[model samples]
Every structure is written in C-alpha cells, then in structure tokens.
Target: MNIVIIGGGGFLGQKLARALVARGTLNGTAISRITLADVNDPAGIEGASLPVETARCDITDPASVARVVTGETDVIYHLAAVVSAHAEEEFEDGMQINLFGTLNILERCRKLGTAPLMVFTSSIAVYGGEVPDPITETSLLNPQTSYGAQKAAGELLVNDYSRKGYVDGRGVRLPTISIRPGKPNRAASSFMSSILREPLNGQAANCPVGEDFLHYYLSPRKCVENLIRTAEIPAADLGRNRILQMPGRTLSIRQMIDAMSAVAGPEPARLITWQPDEAISSIVAGWRFDIHADRALALGLAADASFEENVRYYIEDDRPGN
Candidate 1:
C-alpha cells in the first residue's frame, strides 16, 4: 500500500516515517512506497527498505496537497499544523495551515472516492477551562487556544467526512509529547521538553510554568507506537465515533523534574530555573488534560510506564550524539 506523511520534515513525522519504513507494512499490507510531503522538503532516509519519496507540499494550497494524495495512496498521516504559541501569534497562518489545510487534505481524499485511511493527529489542548479530572470519552471540547480550536474543528471534519463515506478517518487527540529531542520550537508546551532536554544536556533551561502545574504527557517512542496502532484498529470497532484520546501519563512539572533527577541525578535538575511567563502560563492553565483513555486502552494502545521511562527513552533513542 502507498502512504503519505504530511509535515514529514518535523521530528514526529520523520520518526513516524522511519518507523513505517522499518516495519515495511501497515495494517498487514506491505507498503509499496511512502511520500513524505512538507512545506519544506523532508530529509531523505538513507538505504530505506522501501521507496521513500520527499516532496514539498503546501497544504494550504489544494493543488499542492492533491499532487501527493493520489488514487494509489492507501493511508495518509496528516501531522501538519502551525502549533500552539505559533498559531496564537500568527492567526492567519494558523488558520490557513491548521484549519483550511486540513480541509484541503479531506477534499483531496473525497475526490479520490476510495476512502483511504486518514490518521489525523489532534491535541489534548481541545479540552480547556472547567473540565472533569478524568476526561472521559463523552467530555465536551471547549478549546481556549487557537491551536486547540483548530484541532477540535479538524476532528469534527474528520468525523463528518467519515460519516459521509468520503474517507476512512481516525482522529487521535495526542497529549503533550515530552522529552522531544533537539531544540525547542515555538509551542507554548515546548517547556515540557526543554526543561528535561536542556538540563540533561548540561545546559540551563527556563521553566515558564510552576512546579505544581498539571498536564498529561507521553514519550516520543510511545507516541509513534500509538499512531501506528491507531492505523491498525478496525473501523467496525470505531463505528460512528471516529476520535479516540491516546493514553498519557499525567504529571505535574515538579513530578517531571523529579523523574529526570531520578534518572540523571540532581545536577540536571539544578540547571532548571523557574521563571514564569504569563502568556505561556495563561495558555497552559486553560488546558485541563487529566484523562482516562478507556477507548484507547481497550484498543490495546498503551501509555508510557512512567516519566522516568520517558527520560531513559530520550537519552538512549534521541539525545544528541547518543
């Protein structure tokens, strides 16, 4: 089966691409080829087991999106987005890429009429303000940030398009992925990674949120694993409900620091300096991410064992020069 990964230039997309290539199949079918499309050209995978094509795709431009998603495409992993703080800062760019861009992809899938499997990565930022401690399958989406609102809208479109038989869509609301390798991007949640990554690298990191701040997290390894698993789930099981919240480890900023310190010792923790940013804090405060992902668990998707395990995964799998 042919596949496409939009935003394949980014870390998560590239990791997913590598995982797909290494696995050599999806939903029990051997992958014929995978087209990695992004606003910037995705890096080429050296000595790939399958044909990995890299292309420049402007998801905002329907024509550009259409060029990659053809009749032969069997599965589309739509990971493209402007992110949280970036979206909040640049409203038009965010709307164009996050909202209209998703519409463009769905439109292309509709034109195919083949109803290809489309796995859309959503965000837990969809839940905000007042929410249940354990967000259930029935919880309402009241997004406080532009990024969350856009993602919520995307989920609806995916569900509606699936209901219309235009696409076999699966939407998974991802938690804040922590311990991401490399430098932090513009995401308000970037501190989730930076606070751990920089300190472990023996560099100082500024913590914008307080230690008591609560959030849900998942390791990059588990995130990729769950995404693949999401693709394999049967449509019969999902039925009319097209979205599922992926399992995540709920922890506070202090607990996260403690986990890192547990693995790497107090030296890394010492490098973290507390400096609150109201803009970042306000956006994060609106999100109530505590969740019990019953649907995802029943489907055999699993969360990381602990924040400590996540720390080890990063050091071993993604730390610079590891």
Candidate 2:
C-alpha cells in the first residue's frame, strides 16, 4: 500500500508516521511507501522500519498537492491546518489551508478515479456555540470561531466526496490532546499541554483559563492511535457519514494540576500561574468539554485511561534526560 501523510512536520503527524513505519503495515497490507508531505521538509522524519519518502507539498497549491497525492497513493491522512487561535487571527489563510486545501485533495482523488481511503483530521472545535451536553454524531454543527467554521466545512467536504464515491474518506474530530511535547504554538489549546509541559521542564507557564474550566483531552499516544484506527476501519462499517468523533477524557485544570503534583511534585505544579488571557478564554469558552463520543468508542477507538496516565506518559516518552 502507498500512504501519504500531509502536515507530517507537526508533532502528531510525526508520531503517526513513526507508528505506521513501526508497524510496517496497515489494514493487513504491507506498505510499499510512506510519503510525509509538508510545506517545508519535515525535520527528523526518518522511517527505519519501512520505505519512507519526504516532499515539500503546499496544501494550498493544487499542483503541489497533486504532485504528492498521485493515482498510486492508496491512503491519505490530511492533517494540515492553521490552528484555532491562529486561524481566528488569519481568516483567509485558515480558509486557504483548511477548506480549499482539503478541496484540492478531494478533487485530486476524484480525478484519479481510485477512491483512495482519505482520512481528514477535523477538530472538536466544530461543536462550539450552543452545543448539546454530550455532543454526538447526530448533533448539529454550529461553529463559532473561524477555525471551527473551516473544520466544519472540511467535514462536509469529506462526507460529500465519500458519498459521491470519489474517495473512501473518514473525517475524525480530534479532542484536545494534552501533554503535547513541543514548543507552544498559536493553538488556543496549546495552554492545555503547556501547563504540564513547561512546568515539568522547570519553566513557569500561565494558565489562561480557571481551574473550574473543563475540556475534553487525550494523550498524544492515543491521539495518534485513534488516527491510525480511523484508517483501519472498513468503509462499509463507517457507513455513509464517514466521520468519527474521537474519544477523550473530560477533566478540569484543577484535576490536571492535582495529577501533576502526584506524578512529579508540588514544586512543578506551583510553577503554574493562573493569569487569564481573554483571547484564549473566549476561543475555548464555547467548547463542549463533556463530550460522550459514543460512536468512536463503539468503533474501537480508545481514549486516555486517565489524566494521570497522560502526565506520566509525557514524563516517560518526551521528558528530557529520559
């Protein structure tokens, strides 16, 4: 099987690439080649276990997208996007990448007539603005932010394309992945990872939301696992919708801090300062933190066992001096 992963430069994308390479197979088929495509060359992306390739493919450019995603490509995981806060700040750029970029990929697959298994990484941000208590597959999408709106549109594109038999596509709505091991970026949920990531590194981090604030989160490990699982699931089993709401644990900042204290110590926990940022607070305030994600669970996608396990996973895997 030939597989291509867009946004392979990012942490989650790299993790998924590594996992795919490690397994050396997908859906019981031996992977012939894995192309890790991004805007620039993906740094440190080497797959020792399988035949790997890297290319600089800009998603906004159809030619670039087409060059990498050819007729021979069997699976594509489209994960490139401008993050939530960044997308809100740059609306045009977000639409260019999130909306039009996805359109480009779908169009390419349609031209191929191959009906490749395309997996899109949508976000929980799609469920903002007057959401149900437990957001489900049947819930109405009412995105408030520009990023959310773009993702919502992307999901529609994936669904419509799959319905037309252009691609065997799956749109996965990812929960906020906590304890992401990397430098903080413009994502509104970056703070979720930073609160634990920075403090553990002995650097102070500001918590923009209050301790009472709630959100759904998964560990980076499970996030990558769920991404792979989305592709592994048969299209017949997915039905027409082809969108799965990825499962995550619901918890508050206070609970996360408590878990950190237990795993590391109170000193690192003390490094966290509760100084609110209105921009971030407003961006995430509309999010539905207590999502049930029943369909994904039933589909065999797993969630983080607990918040404590998340914190510990960070320490074990990405922690310095490990």
Candidate 3:
C-alpha cells in the first residue's frame, strides 16, 4: 500500500520515515511506496528496503497538496505545521498551512471516495485557559497562541470530515517531544530540547523558561511509536471520537537538568545559560500541559519513563555515530 508523510523533511518526520523503513510495513499491509513530502526533500535518507518518493510540495497550495495524495494512498501521517513562535509572528502563513493545509487534505480524501486512515499530529498547545490539574481527554480547547488555535480548529475539521465518512481520520495531540536531534529553530520550546541536546553536543544553550516551570514531555522514540500505533488502531474501536490525547510525564526544567547531570555528568549541565525571554516565558506560561491521557494509555501508548531516559535514548541512538 502507498503511504505519505506530510512533513517528512522535519526532525520527527525524518525519524518516523526511518522507523517505517526499518519496519518495512504498516499495520499488516506491506508498504509498496512511501512518499516523503515537505518544502524540501528529506536529505540522506532514501528508502532502504522499498522505494521512497521524496516530493517538494507546499502544503498551503491546493494544487501542490493534490500531487501528494492519490487513490493508492491507504494511510497518511500529517506532521506539517507552522510552529508556535513562527505562527504567532506570521499569522497568514500559519492559517494557510496549519488550518487550510489540513482542510485541503480532507477535501482531497473526500474526492478520492475511499476511507483511508489519516493520522494528524496535533499539539499540547490546544489546551490553555484554566485547564484541569491533570489535563484529560475531555478538556476544553482554549488556546492562547495562534499555533494552538489553528491546531484546535484543525482537530475539529478532522473530526467533522471523519464523521462525514470522507476519511477514517485520527488526530493525536502530541506532547512536547524532548531531546530532538537538531539545531535550534524559532519554536519558543526549542530550548526545552536544546538545553539538553546542545549541551550534550558540547555547545552552550539558553534556558528560556524558569527552573520551576513544569510541562509535559515525550521522547522522539515514543512519539514515532505512538504515531504508528495511531495508524494501526481500528476505526470501529475508536467509534465517533477521532482525536486521541497522547500520554506524557510532567517535569520541571530543573528536573531535566538534573537528569542530564546524572546521565552525562556535571559538564553537560554546566553549559546552560539562564537567559529568560519575556515573550517566550509568556507563551509557555499561557500553556497548560499536564496530561493524564487514559485513552492513549489503554491503546498501549506510553511516555518515556523519566527525563533521564529521554536524554539517554538520544545519547545511544542519535549521538555522532555507532
């Protein structure tokens, strides 16, 4: 069967591509073709066991989006988005890509006239205004940021389209994936991973949030695992509910540094510079991400055991080389 990863050039997207290539299949179907579509083609990785089709398509353009989906597509993993800070800075870009891009896919799937399984990567950003102590599946969507607003709206659209039988869609609200393997981007939460990753790589990093600030986190490995699981879950089991809130653990920035110190020694932890940015601090504070995702837990999706486990996972899997 043919499958497509909408943001395949991205860090998490590329990792997911590698994981799919390693597995050689999705659910029970042998993957016949895997399309990697993004603004730029994913570098270095071509399919090892199967053919990997890399397409440079703009999600904001309906014609460009049409090139990616076809009747042969049995599954689609939508990871494309204009992240938080950037979205807040460029409203129109975010609206076009994050909101309309999703609509475009749903419309295309509708035209296909086949119910294909489409998995979307929503974010913890969906929850903001006065949230439950432990964020649950039923919490209201009161987003404070443009990025969150777009995702919340997109989630609704995905659910509505699924209800209309346009596609068998599943939207998973992902937590902040920690220790992402890459350089810092414009995301305000970039420091969340960078504080650990940059220091581990022997570069100094800025800690934007306070030591006491707490947020939910998942590992890159678990993120990919859960995405694959989302694709595999049967539609009948999900009923009318199209969205799944992913599981994550809450920890403070201090706890993360402590975990890093425990894993790699004092040197890595020492490289952090506490330079707070008011805008970033405000955005992070506006977010309420304390997740207790029972639905995902029942489906066998789990968070990384601890902050140290995530740090250690990066050391083992993404460190320079084997």
Candidate 4:
C-alpha cells in the first residue's frame, strides 16, 4: 500500500509516519512506500525497512498538492490546516488553506477517479451554540469561530465528495489533542498541551482558561491509531454519510492538572498558574466538550483510558528527553 500524509512535518503527522514504519502495513497490506508531504521536508524519519519519502509541497497551491496526491496513491491522510487561533487571526490565510486547500485535495482525488481513501482530520470545534450535554452523531453544527467554520465546511465537502463517488472520503472530527510533545502553536487549545507539557519539562505555562473549563481530548497515540483504523474501514460499511466523530475523553482543566500532579508530582503541577484570557475563553466556551461519539465507538475506534494515562504516555513516548 502506498500512503501519503499531507501534514507530515507536524507532530501528529510525524508520529503517524513512524507508527506506519514500525507496523509495516495498513489494513493488512504491506506498506510499499510512504510519502510525507508538507511545506517543508519532514525530518527525524530514518532507518525504516520501507522507503519513506519526504516532499515539500504547499497544499494551497493546487499544482503542488497535485504532485503529492495522484491516482497511484492508495490512501491519503489530510492533516494539513491553519489551526484555530491562527485561522481566527488571519481570516484570508485560514480560508485559503483550510477551505480552498481542502478543495484542492478533493478535486485532485476526483480527477484521479481511483477513489483513493482520503482520511480528513477535522476538529471538535465543528460543534457549538446550545450544544447538547453529550454531543452525538445527530447534533447540528453551528461553528462559532473562523477555524470551526472552516473545519465544518471541510467536513461538508468530504461528505459530499464521498456521496458523489469522487473520493472514498472519511472525516474524523478530532478532539483537542492534549499532552502534545512540542512547544505551543497558535491553536486556541494550545494551552491544553502546554499546561502539562511545559510543567513536565520543568517550565512554567499559563492557563488561559479557568480550572473548571472543559473540553474533549485525545492523546497523540490514540489519534494516530484511529487515523490508521479509519483508513482500513470499508466504504460499504460507512453507508452514505462518510463522517465519524472520533471518540475522546472529556475532562475539565482541574481534572487534567490533578492527573499531571499525580504522575509528575505537585512541583510540576504547581508551575501552572491561572491567568485567563477572555478571547481564548470566549472561543472555547462555545465548543461542545462532552461527546458520545457512538459512531466511532461502533466502528472500533477507542479513546485514551484516562487523562492520567495520557500524561504517562506522553512522558514515555514523547517527553523531550526521552
């Protein structure tokens, strides 16, 4: 099987690449070659049994996106995006990359006519405004942020494109990926990772929301696992709607801090100081932090056992020193 990961330079993308290399197959088919395409060449990948090619391709440029995704490709993992806060601050860039760039990929697959499996990484931000207690598969979308709006739009395209038989598209609405290994980026939920990541690394990180703030979360490990599992799912089973809400744990900020403290000691947890930002709070307040994800669970997707397990996994698999 030949696979292409669009945001391969990013943390989750790189992790998925390494996992694929280690597993050596997808859906029981031996992975012949894997291409990691991004605006910059993906790094830290080496010494794999299979060929792992790195390509520099900008998704916004249709020609560039075309070069990486072709008819010969068996599966495509679309992880590229402008992210939340960045997209909110830069509307034009967000629209260009999040919306148009996605269009470019779908169009390319449509032209291929091979109907390659396209796994799109969407976000929990898609749900907002008068959300139910446990946001389910049947919830109505009312995106409140530019980033949310863009992702919601992408999900619609994925569904429509699949219905049209232009592509075998599967959209997984990802929860806030917490305990991320790297430094913070422009995502409004960056604090979700930073609070734990920085503290564990012996650095201080500010909490942008109060301790009571809640959100759905997934570990980097489970996120990649589900991405691969999504690729393996047969189209016949998906029926008409080609989207699944990826399962995740719902926890408040306090719960996460308590977990961190339990694993890494109170010293690390003490490094987190609450200094709420109104803009960040407002953006996050509208999101549905609790979700049932019945479809994903039924489809064999799973969430992390607990927030504590998430911390431990991060320390073992992606801690800076480790």
lDDT of 2: 0.89
Candidate 2 regions off by >4 Å? none
Each candidate's TM vs. the true structure?
0.96, 0.96, 0.96, 0.96
Q: Write the per-residue lDDT of candidate 2 for residues 1-322, one digit (tens) a residue.
A: 9999999888888889888888889999998888899998986455367778889999899999989999899999999998877788888999899889999999999999999999999988888667667788888888888888999998998999999999999988988888999898877788999999999999999999999999999899899989989999988888768888899988999999999998888899889998889988986787887677888898989998888889899998788878
Residue-by-residue lDDT tens digits, candidate 3, 38-148: 987665365378888889878878788889988888899999998988888899999999999999988999988987889999998988887667778888888888999
Backbone clashes in model 4, listed as residue pairs:
none
- The candidate with the higher lDDT, 2 or 4, is 4
Clashes of 3: 0
The collision pairs in model 2 are none
Q: What lDDT is obtained when candidate 4 is compared to the true structure?
A: 0.90
Model 4: CA > 4 A from native: none
Better of 1 and 2 by lDDT: 1
| lDDT per residue (tens digit) for residues 199-295 in model 1 | 9998999999889999999999999999999999998899788899999988999999999989999999999999889988987786776787999
lDDT of each: 0.92, 0.89, 0.87, 0.90
Clashes of 4: 0
**lDDT winner, 1 or 3:** 1
lDDT of 4 by residue, 1-322 (tens): 9999999999989999999999999999999999999988788487988999999989999999889998789999999998877888889999999999999999999988998899999988888887667688888888888888999999999999999989889999998899888888777778999999999999999998989988899999999999999988888878777889999998999999999888888999889888879988987777787788988888889999989999999999988778
Off by over 4 Å in 3: none
